[model samples]
Target chain A: MLETAVFVIRRDLLLAMRRRSDVLTVLLFFVIVVSLFPLGVGPEPALLRTIAPGVIWVAALLASMLALSRVFAQDYADGTLEQMLLSASPLSVIVAGKVLAHWLMTGLPLVLLAPVLALQFDVPQNFLGELMLSLLLGTPALSLIGTIGAALTLGLRGGGALVALLVLPLYIPVLIIGAGALDAAAAGLGAGAHLLLLGAFLVMAAAFAPWVAAVALRIALE
Target chain B: MLEAIDLQCTRGERTLFSGLDFRLRGGELLRIAGANGSGKTSLLRLLCGLLAPAGGSVRWHGEDIRRLREEYWGRLVYIGHANAIKDDLTAAENLAIACALGGHRVAAGALRSALDQLGIGGSEHRPARVLSQGQRRRVALARLALSEHSPLWILDEPFTALDARAVDIVQEMIASHVARGAAVVYTTHVELEIAVAVALRIDLGAAAV
Candidate 1:
């Protein structure tokens, strides 16, 4: 099972490498969205600092959701999805691998870029670690939850927009807890509570999302 | 070692077929025959555990396939009408990955030789994007050439786009697989062109009983 997961992750990463632009588009969207906040709010350092976590977390949420469609769409289009369902590996394991690869491509970039983007808003340098920590814990949960929406909307007309609509509601909990972690840290309270909640969300999403998404995929294919 | 006992299928409000029965023991060839809208593809998908029947059950070695699930899938190779090739990967990479996904880790050399047998030998380095439609189908079909250990092969419209030479080559491959005591269930619009002595044929137009 682990071999199949690694094989799928390797193959999807190789696919991402060959089509570099798709991966870059999500990263650029996160950067551009986070960057737009300070300009729109003018040059108030205090205001930017206060809003930084919300802005960065929301941007990361959107960026991660942006690439969720690609997770299964190509495979569905070309008949590979059927083969995936029929693989000797359980469908859920293969899905977990695909989701992991997607997070690596789309979610990890947002986490890496958040501290830099937050610094642009003049968020206190001391709080940068908390901002990065919040996004790092939060984005995988975002990707995991986003994949359920993606799988449900697969092959629908207007699926890309539909993914955003279906997923944004589910994303709220992650957004709240993730941004709260930074707010807690910025206020001199420890971020441990919110970070632990985000970690729990990741565990729950990790435990349930792949199997649920796999079930959704089988229904779609049928 | 496969049996469909009184199976029924429906698409939306229309009933495609029902009370369909057949038994495909090892070393047998079962042909699924029907016109365009007659549910041949649905039946193929049903047999391979991709779709649940409206009624009845499909069994492998006398156990329900739904219960068997991945274990059942491990014993078969299914090629649908869609080619399933990725556009960016080279033919060799595509072939090797497909085998790996099917739980078979075929060596790069063995995969290359299978492509050779299918007559696309030297073009293995070219991405599937550059391969013609027929060549891409051959790449999907190449899974068959490497899948002798799998006992059941279900192919949907396997001959649709092939040129004559490729068609003959695939027929020969199927014949050899049957010769090795495996089973094949296939659908084709082409009229009984297979030289292999078929054990059974199900024409969905005349579906029931």
Candidate 2:
């Protein structure tokens, strides 16, 4: 299992390196999205600060989903998915490795880049830490759930739209808690409950989503 | 040995095939011959554990394959119609990654020799997508040389888009694999000269009304 995970991680990283443009585009999209929100809403520091949590979290979610599309889609298209399915490693390990790779490529960058965007929104220096933490816990859940979308939409017509449609609804609870945590921190209230809720969501999603994704992949393969 | 007992499959409202039984022994090759949409691929998928057998079971070494799915899969390598090569990776890198996923290690020298033998030497460093269809097929076939662990090879349309020389190379490779006590099940519509005689044949004709 560890061997499988390491192999997948290496493959994912190598692919991302080879396609440097796609990864850069994801980060660029995130920046463009955060920048657009302030422009559309007008650059009132107070209003931007007030809405910063929602804006940043929403952009992060969308940016991460964009990154998610490349996750299993490339493998599925090339028939690597079938090889993985036939591999000795359990599907759970393959899915877990894939989700981790997705997070590294998508969620980790988003979290790491959040501080810069948070500054753009004039978010309180004190709340920046909480915002990052909320995202750190919440984004894994997003990747886990989005995997099912990636799996189900494998080989489907117009898979891009199908993945977005299937994944966005499932993302609502995580977004609610993720953005709420930052909001509570900014308001000088306890954000622990929201963070805990986000953690719980991540746990459940990590445990269950891979199995669902594996089954969905099997169906798609058939 | 690999055996399927009363295997049945249905695609939605249509029954693709049912009560399918076949056995493949070590050092033997099974050719699954069928026209397009005759469920040849579907049956291969079922036997491979990619698709579940609706009403029967696949057994390996007298144990139900489902109960031992991981072990059974560990021994089998299935290459589908789509040559699973990543167009972005070089032939060597592609074959190396496949070896890792297939749970074996292929030394770089071995991969090079294999690719070279398969007539991909000039473009082993080039991205596979830029290669011709026959070249891509060679890259896919290069995977068979990456491992000595797997004993069963299930290939779908193993001959699609291959030149005569390429076809002969692949046929010899399969022959060598079987001669080494490995079992192979490959799907191909083309008739060709194989170095070894096929041990069993399963041809699916038009479904009875």
Candidate 3:
């Protein structure tokens, strides 16, 4: 069963590798959105610093959502989703494998790119580490939770918009907790509790989101 | 190997089938026959646990298939309307991954042989997207060649978009599998004749069976 999950991850990663543009699209969106914020809001150092956490977190949220449809839309269209459901392994394992691959393709880039983009907002040197750390902790949760919306909205006429509607509301606590981590660090608080909370969200989302998404995929296919 | 007890199916507001019952055992062959939208594909989906019946239960070896999800699924092969091939991957890669996911063990050279037997032998190296509609269906049907040990095979429109020779090859594959004590269930518009000893048909569109 673990072998099946590994195979799914490898297969999806191979697909992503073949379509490099898809992976780059999400990363570039994160970069471009963050870059525009500094321009739209103007680069006053204190003001930029004040809105930096919120702007970056929101961009990450939207970027992750933009990539969410890729998680299942292609497979669902090509009928691989049916094969995945009928696999000898449990659906949850396959969902986890796909979710993990999605994070590596879409989520990991955002985490890796967040701190560099933070400099655009004139974020202080000391706060850069916290911005990256907060995203690193929170992005996987975004991918994990985003998959449920992807599954629920699968095959809908306007599933992409529906995914944003269904999942953005679910992302509230993540936004609060992730942005709070950076705010804490900027205030001379160690960011320990908020970081821990983000980790907790990752863990909790990891445990339940795959199972929920698997069930949704099953019903959607049915 | 499989049984449907008073199965009922509904697609949205319409009931496609109800009071559907059948028994299929190892070494037997059953074909589902129906007109379009008469629930031929729905019955196939229900048999494989892809669609839950609106009523009753589908069982394998006396246990509800829902409870025996992986256990039942691992022992069976199902090829639905979609080929499930990755257009970006070679035919070989597509076959290899599908076999692995279906829990069928493939030897080093078996993937090539499976494609070979299906007449797509050397084309295995080419990506599936370049394959014609018939060739793509051949690639999907190649799975039947590799999964000989699976006791049950459920196929929906297995003959769709295939040439006459390809159809014959698939029919022979099904006959050989059934001869080896593996049960087979399929739905197709094409009339089929198999050399196998046991053959049955469920005419789903004629009336609720």
Residue-wise lDDT of candidate 2 within B1-209, one digit each (tens)? 89999998887777878899988888898988877878888888888888888788888998888789778888888878888888788888888877777777678788899899888877878998798988988888888766545789998988899998988888888888988899998888897656665568898876533
Candidate 1: stretches off by over 4 Å: B206-209
Quantify how close model 2 is to the true structure by its C-alpha RMSD in Å.
2.0
Best by lDDT: 3
Candidate 3 residue lDDT tens string, B1-209: 69999999998888888898889998899989988878998899898999999999999999999999999889988998999998999999899888988976577599999999999898999989899998999999999999988999999899999998889999999999999999999999888797789899999775333
lDDT (0 to 1) per candidate:
0.90, 0.86, 0.91
Kindly list the per-residue Cα lDDT of model 3 for residues A1-222, writing each as its tens digit.
988899899999998998899999999998999899778987688999999999999999999999999899999888888888889999999999999999999988898888888888887899988888888989999999999999999999999889999999999999999999888998898788999999999999999999999999999988
Give the candidate order by descending DockQ: 1, 3, 2
Off by over 4 Å in 2: B207-209
True contacts kept of each: 0.79, 0.74, 0.71
Better of 1 and 2 by lDDT: 1
CAPRI verdict (incorrect, acceptable, medium, high) for model 2: medium
Better of 1 and 3 by TM-score: 1
DockQ-wise, the better of 1 and 3 is 1
Clashing pairs in 2: none
Give the winner by TM-score: 1
- What is the C-alpha lDDT profile of model 2 across A118-189, one tens digit per residue? 888888789988988999999889999999999988888898888999999999999999999988998899
